[model samples]
Target: MTDIKSYMEEKLLQFEPYMLDRVQLLQAPDSLKEAMAYSLQAGGKRIRPMLLFAALETYGQDAEKGFDAACALEMIHTYSLIHDDLPAMDDDDLRRGKPTNHKVFGEAVAILAGDALLTYAFEMVASSKLYSAEQAVKLISMLAKAAGPSGMVGGQVADMEGEQKALSIEELEYIHHHKTGRLLAFSVMAGAFIGGADEQDTKRLETYARHIGLAFQIRDDILDIEGTEAEIGKPVGSDESNEKSTYPSLLTLEGAKLKLEQELDSAHEALASLNRPAPLLKAFADLIAKRNS
Candidate 1:
């Protein structure tokens, strides 16, 4: 597992130059460009990109072929974080052990940075040499749908609306599905499509991503209650402070842990059925459910 993590870190580092090069920082307004670079370069786990690479590896495809898709996914993820940390949203001041984008850049600049990244992500996908025209178009369409109103953005809206209000389990699921799950689902599914996975294989991978996505959020909720700021790189207990709907808020801490385990089991089962070895991805799912950060 440690070896896999190290390998992913190395691969992600290799992709960074090409990733940012796709966007013309010089063309953007100076302030916005600075802000975009700040947040986009901030050290994150690079989980989405890693998932894409792992999925490609599982399919015996060239991981480099998924590079553009991987970088585009990271761009979308970074944009979401910038917007999420705004005063109107999570109101967070820290991320990845550094000040949030809006905290360093003004709110306007942060918003613009996010907007720039979002649009640039599409540009990266469209212009990538990583896939055929048909594959690129399909990947772009899937990514746009996942990042757009019906996916991550929709989930963010639901999360904000549900705040300070009691939410049913189903409503909570809806929020997680769009907010956290869609991008994850897209990460795996896009890799499958790019790697030429068949319908049966793609469906299996989607199932795996969906279960782990929810479990990832559930673990996040638990971590908010149990993880330290030093470990998580953000203030702990923010969920409770904001009266946010979370797994632990609905279920006891122990119950939430149980649910997480159940989700992991389901995710693992789906992966196991694939019969294609994916130790790295499987380990990643476990890490997500068990991580302190």
Candidate 2:
């Protein structure tokens, strides 16, 4: 094993500083900047950026080359989290063991902060010196589609709509596929372009992305039930309280666990199909499958 945990920490150390630098460098209002920086500072696993870095390094490309795209992706993800924590949404008070953005910054400022980050993400990609103009455009288009109404936004709508109803496995997959999977798949594909992947290799990695994306959500559901508040960074069992259908709700806990195994298997098989080694990506799948927080 490559001690992927240590490698991940090393990449994260490089990533977090660059992410903060970009947010700090923005010409936006001090209040808005503070709110945005606060959430980015409240860290999670940074899995999206890690996935991009893994894809890049798999192709022998430098991870630093994907920093702009990675930061942009993380910004969009953080923006979504801020919005998702609002009173009208998930209504969360705690995030990453700190007060949620809306709780600390007030709802209006938090909203603006999210809007600023979202818009700034596209600008970052467009203006990055690391990528060629063509590469920037492709990353932008992919991100816009991934984050916009037809993707993450649309999935949010589906998730909310399905909250009160019984969702089939297919329907639940649809919600997660867009809400979570779209951005995740983009994380890998963005790295593919930055790393100069051929069409066939790109498709294989995408298959890998797709499988792991669902597995990530399934693990989230499992963790919601089994993980402690200290480990989860928030109250556990919110899904049950919210009356949302989860993998465990739709399938029994054991069934959900089995499905998780299936997804991981498929994900690993996709990596095995790759033309080159994808050790980091494989480690990523294992991490998602077994993560506590």
Candidate 3:
């Protein structure tokens, strides 16, 4: 099996240039394009796109075939980050080791850049010549649901509402499942569609994605408490400072760590249910469990 680190790094090299070139061609105002490009190029783990490509690799499909959807997924993720950093939201001033979009581009231009990225994401998928009508439809609809009111947006609202309030474990799960998990889930499901997964196959993979998604969030919460600003690319204890409920706050630090392990274990079990080798997908679960940034 290829080393997951090596595999991920190699894909990152290929994908960054590809996605940036597409952004460079957008015929928009200079300030808008610059804002968009700045956030897109800012350092990130690129976990969503990597998850999509991993799903494709699991099915023995060429990873390149998923690039359009991958880029679309990343764009949506970037847009969310931009909006989340606004004065009205998380009010963060830093992201991925750089100034937040609103801090760099001014609030108006930053908001517009976020809007552009969100809208352009759909165009990236819908205009793809590679997918069949059915595939394109499924991809677009999954992405829409994952990122829309029933998914990420809904979670964001719930998260905002839950701030400074003690939430039950179930309520917390709902917030994370939709906010982070849904889009992460879409990454895997979209790849499954591209690889022609059957209903059963999709179910198993979706299970894996959802578990890893939770695991990913738990780790982020832990990092907020334990990680240095240099490693996490933001100030530590931001969640605590905001009076937001997080895994570590609800479950003790040890409990959150245990929860993270449980989620990763479940993700592996779901992959095992596939009844075939899926080294890359399995490795991704490991990545989510262990990633410090």
Candidate 4:
């Protein structure tokens, strides 16, 4: 397989200027805009947008066709990270090896920045030249569902609630599926939908996303136990500190690792039916499970 990491990095660099320009165009208060820019530019993986582009390419679609949707995905993902680092939430001080948004911008500005990003995500999708009105509507609906109460937000709620409380394996899976998995799934599904993928292809992509989504969180749970602060760019063992329910909490270290491998394999199998080979997508699944950071 090609070097997926390098490929994704190249795409991220290509997308960065446009992403920044779009952020600057948001007509918000200066402080809020600055706060949003701070977090958005804080230098992370840009994995969500990369996945969107990869999925688009997998379907023989121009990556530019999904550019705005990719940007919207990044905005929503960044917003989640900002809120997650707040004192009221994860209380994280550092993100991407720098001060968290709340730490750099103050809590109020950070909160507004996150809000601005979330709302602006929809606007970006609505105004993009990439899709028809119908496609934009569908993309908007998918994104809203993935980011709202039924998806990422709901998972966040479950995650917070599960902290300090013992949870079943199924419950833990539910939390991950919503909290982290949904957006990842949405990223791929949105790409396929806007790329004009047929129903069968969309379903296969969804299956591929779902398996990798769960595996991604499981790998994260293991990473928290085994990875260093430098490797993860975040605190390790935060799950233990917060007494959060996680795959490792339920299955132990070795079991979680094995489960992650199983899910990665399943994801690859799902992708096998695609009309075109998705070497990058396959490599992404492997990288997510084995990532040190």
Candidate 5:
């Protein structure tokens, strides 16, 4: 085994300074900057960027080459979380053991902080010196679509609409795939693209990403029901309180576990097709499958 937990921590430590450098206190008001930095620095697993770098390394590319793109991915992700915690969305209070952006900064400033991070992500991508112009354009387009209505935003809308309703498995899958899965897939695919992976390898990695992505969302649902706030860093049972459809709610806890296993198997199958070794990727799949928080 690669000791993936240690590797992940090393990579996170390597990347944090770069991330902070990108999120500088510029001409923007100190308050807005504070709000943006609050969420960015609060820190989660940073799994998306970790996946990007891991996939890049898998393809024999320098992870540093994808640095800007990795940071951009985290920015967009943080922006989404800030917005997701708003009163209009999931209305969350605590995030990663800290008050949400809206809780500290007011909803209006929180919204602007999210907006700032979203726009800054593009700026970082566009300014990437590592990629050629064509590569930059492609990466930018990939990110926009992944973050846009056809992807995460669309999924968010579907999730909100499906709340309080008993959505079919297919409908729930759609929401999970679009809302959470797309970005995760993008995280993996973005690395492949940056590393100039061949068409076959690209498709294979995408398949792995898709499988893991769904599994990630399913694990999230399981955690919401089974994890305590002290462990999860947020309130549990919010799903039932909001009358939201979840994997456990629809498929039963045992059934959801089975689905996660199925997805993990598919992910492994996809990785098996790749010519290169993927110890980190394999470890990541297991981590997502078995994560408690």
Candidate 6:
């Protein structure tokens, strides 16, 4: 009997210190360092990096080769969280059970911290030691597009603009796919690329990434409604309070749950094409679907 949770947690712990060390090595002013470290150290599940490692392992490659890319992804993600918590954005007060970056570091510093992380992430990708120059460029380009205006940033813009307005399912799906799904997809795709997976396998993994990413967001919406603050580590109903559209709001709670299951099924179907055991990937999908927080 394998405890997938503990397994993933151990895997997350493995490279986190590497990332922390990289952040510390930056020659920045104390305030900027503190601000950046604050949110970066404020840990979440480290799902993006873990997915990268898992995907690499799926193709019988050493996960260490993807470490730089994994760390880069996490940095981009952390920067997004910092920006998202700013007063101009979601205006969040708390994150992962603690005061948000802005709440602790002031809005201006928090914004700068996010900007620093975003730029530093590209530096990390460019300076990776394990990959060829060509591979590095590919990784850098993939991350930029995923985190750029065409992807997460664009989705955030749509989300902000969509507030107080009813969005159709197609419109909402676009938001979820681009905003959250792109990076997650990149995690898998990048991992596959590093692992020497064939094009067909990479495409299948992309489909898997899409399904899991949407399921992850849908579950987040469901948890916002059904999960307790203690469990979710933030105030529930904040979405409704912000008047933002959500899966539960759009599909109804029951409908959202059904959609979640359907997405999960679609994810598994995508995995079936791999013809290889993906215990971690399967466990990850189940975890996303069932997470209380």
Highest TM-score among the candidates is held by which one?
2
Candidate 1's C-alpha lDDT? 0.87
| lDDT per residue (tens digit) for residues 61-159 in model 1 | 877888889878998999999999999877888898899998898899899899988988888889877778998889988998998999999998888
lDDT of predicted model 5: 0.90
**Local distance difference test, candidate 2:** 0.93
In candidate 4, the residue pairs with backbone N, CA or C atoms under 3 Å apart (3 or more residues apart, or in different chains) clash, namely none
Cand. 3 Cα-lDDT = 0.91
User: Which candidate leads in lDDT?
Assistant: 2
Model 5 ranges with Cα > 4 A deviation: none
> Cα lDDT of all candidates, in order?
0.87, 0.93, 0.91, 0.87, 0.90, 0.89
Question: Candidate 5's residue-wise lDDT over 71-146, tens digit each?
Answer: 8999999999999999998888889889999999999999999999999999899987889999989999999999
After superposition, the stretches of candidate 4 with alpha carbons farther than 4 Å from their true spots are: none
Q: TM-score per candidate, in order?
A: 0.96, 0.98, 0.98, 0.96, 0.97, 0.97
Worst 10 residues of 2 by lDDT: 1-10
What is the lDDT, from 0 to 100, of the residue 16 in candidate 2?
Answer: 90
- Better model by lDDT: candidate 2 vs candidate 6: 2
Better of 4 and 6 by lDDT: 6
Ranking of all candidate structures by their lDDT, best first: 2, 3, 5, 6, 4, 1
Candidate 2 collision pairs: none
Q: Against the true structure, what is every candidate's RMSD?
A: 1.4, 0.9, 1.2, 1.3, 1.2, 1.2
What's the C-alpha lDDT at position 136 in model 4?
A: 91
Higher-ranked by lDDT: 2 or 4: 2
